[model samples]
Target: MKTQQRVGAGPGRGLAAALGATVCAAVFTAAALPGTAWAAGESPYGFDGGAQPIKGAATSLDARPLTAGQSYRDSIKKDGKLYYRVDLGTQENAYVSVVAVPKAGGAAEYGDGITVTLQDGSGAQCGYQDSSFASATFTRPITAYAHRTIEPDRSTCQQAGAYYVLVERTSKAASPPDDWQLEIRYVPEPGVTQNGPTELPENWPSSSPPPPVGGPQKRQGGTGFHDATSLRQGEWRADIEPGQTLFYRVPVDWGQQVFATAELGSSPTGATGYVPNALVLSLDNPARGHVDQNTVSYDGKPATLALDPHRPVAFENRYSSHSTTNALRFAGWYHLSATLSPEIVKEYGDRPVQLTLRVNVTGTPKAGPAYAGDAGPFQVTADDRDAAASGASGDEAGTNDGMVVVAAAGIGAGTVLLAGLGVWSFAGRRRAARDAARGGPGGPQDGPSPFGPPPPAW
Candidate 1:
């Protein structure tokens, strides 16, 4: 009779079970790493990782509610109009911005764009803004904003009640039919204890100043408003690829005037073909409201795009009839975005084009209005000033580089740990099976096992 033997109760089996648990733990550790490690290569128009997914209603009746100081991600079909609701207090001003990102390499007409409007429940329009692809030969992300301001003399949209943000896409028959991704942000400004002059400044500098003088500092631009690289008055250098956009922010305090110029270097491949609106540079206020924009054509040659001379940041600028001046109503991080058209990919090869940014912030900083409550994200704090001066990204501030290094190291270690554990687990199982077949711990060895040498004693 064969000797009685108990199956699945030996030390080898125990070791195999423990190894499986170790493998799982290794995987968990890797998964817990900070997500920003992978963000470096993400698309410039990608939505924020922390943005909440939301669906916009076709009509105001079913409109979703948007909270202040939060971002929501959604999509809009061609020619589709979507509505969202926001409840506001009479003491605060609400600014809403919508960013529409078209499909990469998609067909788009010059007039294709998006419109945003803020209206009262009774259909009274408070503010409206629209952005277009303009002369761009290819699709890219465009932004527009609307606001509901509580002014002393303003009549409409002043009540402390619900307001609707209407977003409408304008597309031609030749435009791509795919739905465009949308990033919606709502920023609320508290009422000021003391109001500034309501009249626009009569005598402000209107001439563009000379560009900043210095050697260009290497700085990697961020993807969007949330991650815009911080820069002070200086010339910064980076690279741009076709269909890519880079965002940077400059802290413009009250009484300070900011100017920027974007220069695109000649094509690397020397490929020659004229493409209209090949490069576009835009400026937006702290609320992400469009301030001004300039575009230039490209033909394998260097090109420069400069923004119009902007007035200093002042509370009275809000009363100006000019959109550029009106947008300079607050002191905060002003965003600068540079976009290279996809048409360059066809005319010029896919090589990254060298780009240089000349940024100038002049004038002494002045005191801001006293707010009844916290000034929220629109106010530039001491930390923000420091970050800008040090040339750091907005999200990570001063520690972005360190965090990236730590994340890379952690990832490397995790990969090695997981790989080692996987090998050990495989070897241990093979050895356990071989020993079990031979009858127990003191079983006979049948030459060298095929899997590998037995796992080292743990």
Candidate 2:
């Protein structure tokens, strides 16, 4: 019996979902995973004990390509065809050992009973390779402490990606009573990650590619280099075929203090049809200069961006399978921006930043005519034409006169101080409730004026 599982592969749309197969050890999972990172310096385990034929039918460019270990002389009188490969025999960052099919031909003598199964090339089956049967098998095979965690199902296989084997025949019968051989053991990185860390830099390439500048033509002008290999390795994928429109020219700074931040990547085939991802920032550099743009649809692998806050300008495509490409087939790729907050050249002074990137292909913008610069010259005078047409003023007529009567006298003094604070707190709470309903000294209408001092003169 034999078994290995680490699941986690996805499927559903424009692509991106399939990564989870790095179990490395219940018996042998080949850990250090990154979508299936188990290259433990060459051998995660693909079997070499000797029976042969277990790696996904063969070398698997699509499957079927092995030759050194295959033998099946009519078992169930039918079953045959297997493949596996991985014998680095040497290390130093090198990898590819093999092992992921688990059982089909020998092992069973008391009565010829053996069952080893482990699948994920999309046949499903994953639970029954008994070390004891408490659940799935694995009391042996895949040495160096163990290994067997491959999850490749070909939608582009990448649940943990890294693959190289596919052994099959999970029923085992027709010739055998013992002596099972399939033990791939090659320890140099037993726990994995034996030498891959210093923070980052094994090949150090995710994309820092910055270099696409060629501005200044001025008269309906033109220059070059728009993603020039994204400077040779920073992410600039291409596979277009929509309307095809990709052009670049950035040196924007035309007049009008700016503050830029551009990021727009879209993909739409239908839904009223808009296809966003456009960035234009053109003024051809005259003062501020900003060109941040967007237009995503090589399925979302666009480029050109940097704002540096220490690294605060962005536009990523998340690409790296050891990338090395530039096959140009445009349909969409845009990212434009403008930022220059000193009031954008303080109103036109540094004249020297022109921009013109094109990409709206079938939707309209192939960009052609637009050239005319510097406009400044005026002379009206009639007291400057009554303060430019009548905000009328001899010396600024009464402080720009009646701004709606000063906002209605400041809303009538805040409505008379809130009606005198709501009538002095409601007349001081009704005069303390009429002095507590009069339970005090003077009663009988409260003395002092009864026919008055009549007997006082006697």
Candidate 3:
């Protein structure tokens, strides 16, 4: 019945087709909208050539405390850097990540690269990582994780006191950027108690990790946090810009396990120009804690991630018995964030990269244990799961029909676009094959015998 709501929330194909036709008719009857007028030879999306020097913008270092399962959203200017404070216990681990989104319209291109540094109160650098934008089009989130202390000794940053995180732009622009949205995610590792030899679970390395079981692939629709698309069981297809990031949420009841794989589609000519080691697929728990993460190069390979309750421990933190043993403590909405770096966009321009997503959400929702305390902010309702997946607003009941219609139209349009892309890709491959066979002056296969065996060294 619950899964039905996810699928039935949107209109059927027949209704969507009919509605699309009606919408197209309405569009034809209306006058065409005028195109945007801009100054000649100036970048339309860039600043209006009125960018000010970065030095002029004043910034104050304000360190805000970060907590587990919390994301702080703010903005930073081109010349400015944002700082946050984080405190760690000797027994706990800390993980931090920053995601930057360009502000709409009148934005100046602040080339790739944003630097994040972790330092102590005395200004000593601890651990830092710099994340470059995939392209001006999109940026993949950058992350860093560290424990309270290292055995032999690495950096002074691994201590029980206060640590600061600094985020700044690495590229300079003619005009100062208005601001870019930054989402900071912090995860506090669960503490572990040294219990005797650690009663190793049967799922531990005593047995090899199971290989991912191939399943149906599904399409993703939401390309950002605000519009993450809903997903159900089945094969789906979609296209993404080279540097685009997509968010999708799935409902996992108590005792459920989720497995997903993301694969890059071959280019039009069956060869992607350059692959960047920037495709990252991350899974977050209901509380927004970093449960697990994986990064893979888009070199025509699939990246797979599975949250099997049999082994909730992330490969990186498996040594920590406490965190891994209790990783799956919640049963609610799990968020999946998938991103491709801008290098693809830079090399391919507006050409879309097709992606096939395979998702397996198994298990039924079992009744949770009764709570003795008062109902806090989270009472856990049946609708909570679906609401998060749908990005539904407060007045969902009133706009159910409208939302269904809109979603139907969107899904229909997405399918048609994919079809067009497939045809274009096939045509490109055919043309390339024909050109190679011809081997004419302009063909890529021209003059292939130039350096064969150094002319037999005669």
Candidate 4:
């Protein structure tokens, strides 16, 4: 049998093969590029890119199970209620936060928002929280969280069983009927092995300490909790657009008290109409549980929102009557979010406004609780404190699995591209030798080509 002679064995075929390899390499590299990072000043809320898509059930009977330390993305219709299940140990504290994003440019009344509740298997309520748009005239994302703590004094809802999370949309007739986007996160805290104080501190500082004294450092805020910029005790500045929310995380160690103030710079437009709740600054605990929030009206002038001073981070704070103090029970990265109402765009001409965060973390870092099990991300580590002090963003400060995968894929693509070029060069040399043996460019070619059939004409 005669060996099938190579077809189109020449410079053209070699060049074609190289081009194909190059294209494939380029495609692979493009696919591996980071696509989840959101721009700093975007309007709409950016959900956690790594969150799992979950379908919430209408009732507890058919509710889907949510695992601890996982984030889920779902949706809720107008006036709709949804249920999710979470199994907890007797000594573990479970926190579930739901962020509801209203339709952009849609109408929303002052009372429009959501309510989150944690209930036991018997339908006994463990915790409940309500978040509303309040005085803002435009739609934005509102976060509400409910938690079930293993307290000794708690009579009900403190068992090692399955619990249900109920999320309900609370809106008036004037609000838009569109389904709101939901970002749900479940964070579990392991019970401490060592016992700490059981009573609230009798005499703690109640007055807000002075804001951090330093020149403002430029830092772009992240769009979601997972990527919130890491902030330390200093003045940080970022530009925020109307209807945009920026997230930042501050590492608060045990015995440390965090005081934060958000200042919206004077509007360049010099517009006159006053917008209530024009700027909102919120502080959330490591579990994404609401600690405190402050809002201020804006009239083209600089507006400041400052969180009230609370008890320092302590395990006993959880026994306090106030929810704010209760949320300071752990030492971890406390998230701060600054949101600009969309109503400002109407009068301010949709320009980006300067946002300044004055953060002061007081008290020396002390030893934290010894957990029976792993505390996971609920506890701040030495690396976390170092990252904050170095002004590293969340992505740079912590190990992000998504980004690691992307980097690995990128390196692999580069290797493949380099190997393909080497093969292309070898093929070209062989083709040239074969032509020379046949006496010229117009010579006969024999033997099957090592490289498969030439790629189709480009």
Candidate 5:
């Protein structure tokens, strides 16, 4: 297919690059403004995450219970399909994600695939998806999440109450009998809050089309930004094998813009009919809503695909090119998910593909409006440091009040020095303690994810 069009050239592209750049710039400028940093409110709707391990699949008709706004992880053996029971409210949205990890010394075949199904209590099927290795050998972790049920008004599975999640290997026997790790989390989005950003930037170019791709630029990482080993201002490195998907989370504040590119290491030798676009990188906004998708094509050299929103962050119109609207309307932990083409793995054999993921986060985290209700555990206003202190239950002291007070004192003292210091210094002191309790850097564990087409039938 031809490369993506320039921003705002097509329908809905009006929210094109202009929206991207100007919105990001305005957000950042607002953040940098004095006394605006601490006012940021956290998003009230998201994963109400509390994880519990599934001991094993229930035998017979018995299914393990899964709670909404919680997460569960466990291992399942080959040919073993685990079933879990879910009880959801009529207004609540349910999501489930299953990640299949091949055991050490296992076949390591990237073509291995799995099937996940959601069924209502009365034996009616609600939703189902099959994920494959996609013909690549160097496999990374394969993950998939989808809403368990259609919206309440929909015809199918409309009622709330008991539902089932079933997971089983779908790949051929040649792949080997490896144990797979299953991370399952069900998120219930509180239906009460408004679904869009607090505000849109002025002079947002509502009438004009977006310009061409902006050239590359440099970005600097803010201090105390590395809490979850998240992608920062500069570039980060990762290795992905075919059939495997790697995930990285970058915290973007209300005003900041985020741009990322995945450079595939090298094309496999003697591979033919292989599409140059061997890699697929997807961006999910803070609420785990998919925003953009791009691919790295391998011509003679490593093909780089810009995986940012169209216009403002990068020059390419990935929104139109990918045929998906950019839904990056909010701030928080936007996730970068990378996967390789199975065709490459089929030809190259299972081998690690070196990749450089260049992530650019521009703008600053300005304070957000304080909502009437408590924000979930995840806060977009605070960086990794504050997120760490909040922990899963979100019971940290001096949250919004602490930051604002400290920042005000620093400003009065006539120094951005203490401004930065006040924002992160105390938070940094809690880092060691938080890390010890929360464990190391990890991606979002909750499972509700975008539902899309499965791999083509063989």
Candidate 6:
């Protein structure tokens, strides 16, 4: 790839930016402007913002400084495309954050954006893989700045040098120069050796075998930000009425999941299904996030539940009256059984500081039905309720087979329509989440994703 391009370019300057990005930037010069940090109703939109509203196209370079509260903003409108740039520049591990604003809400719209491209000196494309940071995180804005790990990619721009950072917004036309604001910021990285200011490498060692994620992961410790998302069974509902008996049972020999948790709590508003016992779990506790004794709900009549990655998860929207909605963060423990090869078990089973979780609930307190596993697969078989009660119609082994496949295909087309392209990668994990992204878009058969091949035959 072409490595070197003319430097210091701007709108109509004929200067070329690395990575072929049209928009370019220079080191920011401090301004002695007054009240750049004002309060509410004093900002450009009279909304306590810091920077004034400057509008332009994503292709232009007249970008203005982001105001104070770059993370927050006034609801302004613009008729032209919003342009912006990200500069980590020599800052060893600087993090980036961006938020886009638009005018309409009816039909789904693309609000903010960033033109992302990684390359080495001379501008040759880098083949990247195993990207911990190369992800599209929903529930949050693009956060590549916070991630310190870069994947394995062959790039021509390897050495420490100028790298282009570009971002553009995609949304409906907005009311120009009015209550409009696009937020952006740069946060520093952690565990970094030196805080040396830096930019995207113009070049890196060609012989280097991509960077390793890190070494000796801690077991039974908090899940790092990299864990991405988790699917856990939250809690049981109901008031702590007298003599309330609640129960929960999970797999055993699957070896206990150290990083995960299983919790049961109740609310006072509505007296729903009642449980006899409950308590919070912490790293300070022995069972960790696992349950104790007598609390396990099983015997012949067991319970079966599913975590819909789509459908926004149960209790995600409305809170059960019997829940500690106002009391706690609504976080719950996970009833999980993992499948790991001997190698994986050997590698992580005994590691210190593993993924640890803290479990708790906020309402009235009671007790009973706590079961923790030491070793063995959980077998919650029900009798007259039909073998289907445990969710298996016939052979339990056959029932657990192809879990990923079943979860993906069974999702409605609406959910799949909502997910982004990069997320809809694996027919398994990606597809299920995609199904959840579906809103009022095309029908379930909106064809295949614009990013990948069509779905598999059922």
Q: Each candidate's TM vs. the true structure?
A: 0.78, 0.18, 0.45, 0.78, 0.51, 0.25
lDDT of 6 at 164: 32
Error of 5 at 309 (Å): 5.6
> lDDT values of the candidates?
0.72, 0.21, 0.44, 0.71, 0.47, 0.22
Clashes of each: 0, 65, 7, 0, 22, 74
lDDT of 4 at 371: 78
Q: Tell me the tens digit of each residue's lDDT in model 3 across 364-438.
A: 444432333222211234455344323332222112222223334454665444433443344345435533432
RMSD of 3: 18.3
Q: After superposition, how far is residue 122 of candidate 2 from its true place, in Å?
A: 20
Query: Across residues 1-458, which tens digit of lDDT does each residue of candidate 4 receive?
Result: 00010000099788767756754554444333332323432225656645678999988989999977667888899899999999888888888888887665456877778888999899888887777766665676667788887776666877888899999997788777888888898888787676767887589878887766657777667767766777777777788888788888988877788999999898676677888888888888887767788888988788888888888888778776666777787878999988888778778887789998998788766666777887677566767765665555564455443433334455456445554454445434544553344233221111221112212211
**RMSD, candidate 5, Å:** 17.8
Greater lDDT among 1 and 4 belongs to 1
Model 1 C-alpha lDDT versus the unseen true structure: 0.72
Q: Which parts of model 6 have CA positions greater than 4 angstroms off? A: 1-83, 86-91, 103-105, 109-163, 170-181, 194-458
3 or 6, greater by lDDT: 3
Question: Which has the greatest lDDT?
Answer: 1
Worst ten-residue run, lDDT, model 1?
A: 1-10
TM-score of candidate 3 on Cα atoms, chains taken together: 0.45
lDDT of 5 by residue, 1-458 (tens): 11111111075565445444433443344234322222343111111122345764654258878765455667777667778777776654455666555532234444466666677777666655455545434344444444443332355666877778777676566666656766566654433233223223333222322321322222111111111234444444556665545556665654456678777756556344345447877665443334566666554356677754432321111122232222343345666777666556556667877676676555434444233333352245334433422331121222322333334434333233334344444445544454454343322322221111221111
lDDT tens string, model 6, 126-213?
A: 2110101011111112111111222124123334443332333233453123333444443322222322222222332223122122
Model 2 per-residue lDDT tens digits across residues 233-279: 01122222121122222211111011222222332321223222222
